[model samples]
Target chain A: MKYKDYYEILGVPRDADDDAIKKAYRKLAHKYHPDVSKDPAGEEKFKEIAEAYATLKDADKRAAYDRLGSHSPGQDFQPPPDWGTQYGEQDLRFEDIDLSDLLAGLAGGRQRGAGRRGTMAMPGEDYEVTARISLEDAYAGTLVDLNLSVPEYDANGRLHRVPRVFKARIPKGATHGQRLRLRGKGGKGFHGGRDGDLYLNIELVPHALFRPSGHDLYLDLPLAPWEAALGATVAVPTLAGTVHLKVPAGTAAGSKLRLSGRGLPTPHGKPGDLYAIAQIAVPPKLSEAERELFQKLAAGSTFDPRSHFNSEVKHGD
Target chain B: MATEPVEPAWLNDDARVSLDELAALSGLTDAALRELVDYGVLHPVDAAEAQWTFSARWVVVARTACRLRNDFELDLNALALTLSFLDRIRDLEAQLRSANAQLPRRHY
Candidate 1:
């Protein structure tokens, strides 16, 4: 097996004090912590740091590791003849440890195996993963296909990830950040223990036209200048279908028109409302006749759009 | 080859989880979980420690707490406080997201 330099991994000297080792670990831990870090390799780096700290922090493990000699990292080596016997007698067991293959072979040999230590039942580890779905899928239930790489143990008790594929149903009203647990779908158990559960964290993908806020939906409704000036019934799109929205006379931009119970459907209670926000749009280029008509209307009109700004400026002066 | 269609079992807030199951899922020892309870980090279903039952959502809570504890080497009390703060941050972030979703999209 390839040898691992725990000291090198932690960026500490071999003879460093406990305080120094801890300081180095804490700094690295903060930098590589998966929850806080945005780095793509943060999880893997954190795992490596944790493994290094776990071995180096313990005096016995550090001594045992040091006794293996001055081999460089990735060097091919084996534990001394009496190494296992010495550590085995101490009843040291590594629990919930995701170790490298070399360390797993050494630490997990007799203690982790089932038959050699008699039949023992250990519940398999639970797995958590995020599943992203569209807003439409969240509104109306849909089937989603998922390909998972699940870790499994071989006949020789080695860990390897095997590809698993299945289709799951995303229930209606499944909100963002909701966790759906699948029973007995995680890692396989040992010695007849029950398999662990899998937790699917729901993430709703953003929609192009609709913005979802809890159960409510919002849509930007573009209106012509004449449509805003005069009351008009226009078609608005909802998740279910298109419906006609009545804009009141002299409707201004940024006005929100609420359509009751037109948003996402809920299992219980009142369904949410959809809001169509008005945005008055003008033609980019007008023809000669249209320009002449606009010019005549502008010459006749006395409406001041910046009256509020003028009032505020006068009051300030 | 055809893949199997799996029906997912959704766990609600009311779903019960045993102490051992919680420990296995969270990677925290039973003693650490008890300490968490003492520190007000976890609220079990019943008062008795022996037959204590937790909600299935505690699995996520406990796992997150366990990760923070391992990364920071924090004591139980500090860990509990940190977890509470983290929960507040998550809640605020969700609220912000919901509020932002209500705003009209800007097309440049």
Candidate 2:
């Protein structure tokens, strides 16, 4: 029920050229395709990506969508009444030229029909479920038990609750709202056709120590002010465990330490590096003893960090 | 009173035919079994020239490979890679669990 920014979802700028949009969509589609991905929630994400590209890829539809301005697909959606009449009178048919049947693969086994129908067939129903993973479990990748709450209608026509337990694998680099599909896991197929897939959308809870990046891990390493200026050997956390890291001497603030082959491993066995970005922590309050020591140290040093500011200044002749 | 730890279901269960019996029963060629072994998904006890034995675990591994290839539509190389990672994760998890359990709990 949330409004998704199609351009942002496709990793494209709002003013991106049509060629750029197409290129981005194609590359992302190939990567997140359910058939190719081992991600537990890949199919639904593929559908969302397809839906985003479907509207944004067209010129007229993109214009209308842009004008709608931050509304969900069916939220108070009404087109201009005279617009269809104008097109009808102009002898122009908005045939399904823009929407190819290629999207059916993204929606999971939905087939194209023989008729010239304007709208696409109802997509296979998608089911949303949650998967929880520990930071290490997410980094190394592991199978998870997903408790799915499926709604079932009783003979009296009242909806009842039915819970199903499924085991799904969460691949490395999975992000929030990324979808995975289980074949024949959704509602029964219409007309005795194969059932739709069960879509698991990921929602990763916060970890006490580890954070996730795309095939990488992030963690905040608290460093002393002295450690930032005059470096020290520190123990840093990684997906495998904590490892000793060398903070190079004279390292400035915002410097990053790269620990090679210490992050999440890709399916192809290539691993990402752990990045330890430097953050100089300034104490909020200092005791009189500490303040005196700092004042003496400040007086002893003849260093001006902004010394280059005046040197770089250029005056008009 | 402290409660005893529960063992995993896989552990308490009977040592079903080690990968060797599975190979003899499955009638699959040695080449196919080698492929499964190379993927690191199936564990075999011994390897010899035309005399290697596989556990019944290979059947499950083979089925998983089949599902990954036929149903999920992954290529052989990708399927192999996915299974290899899954095995590595499982191994790491077991090690972590053992290490955590072995550490003495410090109660303040």
The candidate maximizing TM-score is: 1
Please give the range of 10 consecutive residues that has the lowest summed lDDT in model 2 chain A.
A96-105
lDDT of model 1 at residue A162?
70
lDDT of 1 by residue, A11-74 (tens): 9989998899999999998898876676869887987888888777867667777876768887
Give the Cα lDDT of each candidate: 0.76, 0.56
Residue by residue across A1-317, what tens digits does model 2's lDDT show?
Answer: 23457887788988998889888877876677664566757777776777778777767557655653665533333334454343232222222112222222212212332122213433234354567666566666667766655543234322333566666666665543344445556543333344545545566676665454544545555677777778899988776777999997787655667788887665445676666666667767988988998899899999899999988998787
The ten-residue window of minimal lDDT in model 2 chain B covers: B5-14
The global Cα lDDT (0 to 1) of model 2 is 0.56
Q: In model 1, which runs have C-alpha deviations exceeding 4 angstroms?
A: A1-9, A13-21, A38-41, A55-99, A108-118, A266-271, A313-317, B1-3, B11-58
Clashes of each: 0, 11
State the iRMSD of every prediction, in order shown.
Answer: 3.3, 15.7
Q: TM-score, each model?
A: 0.77, 0.42
DockQ of every candidate structure: 0.46, 0.03
